[model samples]
Target: MNSSDAVDIATDALVVIAKISAPFLLVVLAIGLIVGLMQSVTQLQEPTLSFVPKLIGAAVVIALAGPWMLDELVGFAHELYQRTPQLLEG
Candidate 1:
């Protein structure tokens, strides 16, 4: 309804997005570092070497956290829905 409310919604949405993305991002970053280290140790400088591990790591993170993430998203959606009328009134 106003700039402050809009800003609050945007901030909340960004926080949720960061929370949801952090695990996968961290997993991929870790896997990438490990793969890079291994590549350096073996001296096989293959660019694609990092992709599979990072992808797999991200996939595993998604598999492990998918349900919880979905629940969080759904809860946020519900909250937005519940607050819709109030926001409209404001």
Candidate 2:
């Protein structure tokens, strides 16, 4: 309820966001790098070439780790909910 509590909640939210997004971002980054390298070697500059792989990589990451990400978010929400009474009383 106070500034410190708000800061703590904000920090926790940011951590959860980073944790959930890391996999997808990393996968996309790696895929994009590889695609870029391939394009450089092949001397082909096609926009879709880079776009498709990154998209697929992100989709695959979501498909594989979606449940875990959802669990993380749900856990954070549950924790925040549990702390509601304490926060409100402050």
Candidate 3:
């Protein structure tokens, strides 16, 4: 309703998004780094060698953390819905 309210909502949404995505992002980053190190050591320089592991790492993170991510998203949505009336009244 107000600029401050809108900003708060936007910030909360961004935080939810970051919380949901962080695990996958961190896992992929770590996997990529390790793969890069291995590639350098062996001088393989294969693209897929780097990509596949990162992809798999991301997928594994998603699979492991999917329920928690869903809970965070659902909680955020529920909070927003609960605030809708107050927001509208303003």
Best by TM-score: 2
lDDT of 2 at 54: 84
Clash totals for all candidate models: 0, 0, 0
Give the per-residue lDDT digits (tens) of candidate 2, residues 1-90.
899999999999999999999998899889988988998999999978888788889889999999999999999999999999999999
Candidates in order have lDDT scores of 0.88, 0.94, 0.91
Residue-level error in angstroms, candidate 1, position 21: 0.2
Report the CA-based lDDT of candidate 3 relative to the real structure.
0.91
A best-first ranking of the candidates according to their lDDT comes to 2, 3, 1
Query: 5-60 in candidate 1: lDDT tens per residue?
Result: 88988888888899899999888888888889999999999998788888889889
TM-score of each: 0.95, 0.96, 0.95
Best by lDDT: 2
Ten-residue region with minimum lDDT total, candidate 1? 49-58
Q: Following a full C-alpha superposition, what root-mean-square deviation does model 1 have from the true structure?
A: 0.8
Error of 2 at 69 (Å): 0.1
RMSD (Cα, Å) of candidate 2? Answer: 0.7
Model 2 vs. true fold: TM? 0.96
Candidate 1 positional error at 68, Å: 0.9
